[model samples]
Target: MHIKTKFFGDIELSTEQLWHFPKGIPGFESERKFALLPIEENLMFQVLQSTNDSDIALIVANPYTLVEDYSFDIDDPTIELLDIKQEDDIFVLGVLSLKDPLETSTINLQAPIVFHTSKKVAKQMIINDNKFAVRHIIGSQPSLTKEEA
Candidate 1:
């Protein structure tokens, strides 16, 4: 199907490429369905575009790639919501807050977006731990080099 996007304009995607967020992302509770679209030439980041609304796209990335020691337990409620069975069944991504300078960008580590691969469902699970910040500075963390990304 074809859908309008905030960054990529109009594009075609398979139905399997869409994700269903039953409860949707925090501030975007009304927007549930989304598609994880890759940024051209950038492996480290992706556009989590809402299939329902072209203006609601968010830049996301794997937190592990930005933070070396990033670790958090998925809350019981979220685990049950997505029907996650095993570690391999889910993948996590964090929303990014881009800044003027590339290095000044921050990622939301406190709340990671979890996707159930098989079910094609997802949610932004908020971590109860204080070890992570809502806006963790990406520049201070060890991340993939430009060549690697």
Candidate 2:
């Protein structure tokens, strides 16, 4: 199917490239379908483009790459919503807030977008824990003690 995107402009996509968000992402509940489009030459980031709306696109990346210690449990409600069965069935991506210098950019670690690979379903889940910040600087690295380093 051919669809227009905010960053990528008009492009053709296969059915397998589409993802169905039953509950949709926060604030955009009505926008259900999305396509994960890759940023040219960048494996760390991807654009979560709403198939229905050209303006509704989010830059997302694997939170683990930015925060090595990032960890969270998939709440029971989300598991059931996405029908997730095992760890391999799903992968998580955090929405990125691009900044002018790029190094000043931040990622929304508090709410990670979880995708079920086989099911083609996804949801942006808000973590109940306060361990992660809403806007974690992408360039910031976790400080390690001298012993650990």
User: RMSD to the native, candidate 2?
Assistant: 5.9
**Candidate 1 per-residue C-alpha lDDT over 3-122 given as tens digits, one digit per residue, 9 for 90 to 100:** 999999999999878999999888999998999998876778899999989999999999998988999999899899999889999999999999977789999999999999999999
Residue pair clashes in candidate 1? none
Off by over 4 Å in 2: 140-149
TM-score for each candidate, following the candidate numbering: 0.93, 0.92
Give me the overall lDDT of model 2.
Answer: 0.91
The pairs that clash in candidate 2 are none
| Candidate 2 weakest ten by summed lDDT | 140-149
Clash count for each candidate, listed in order shown: 0, 0
lDDT of 1: 0.91
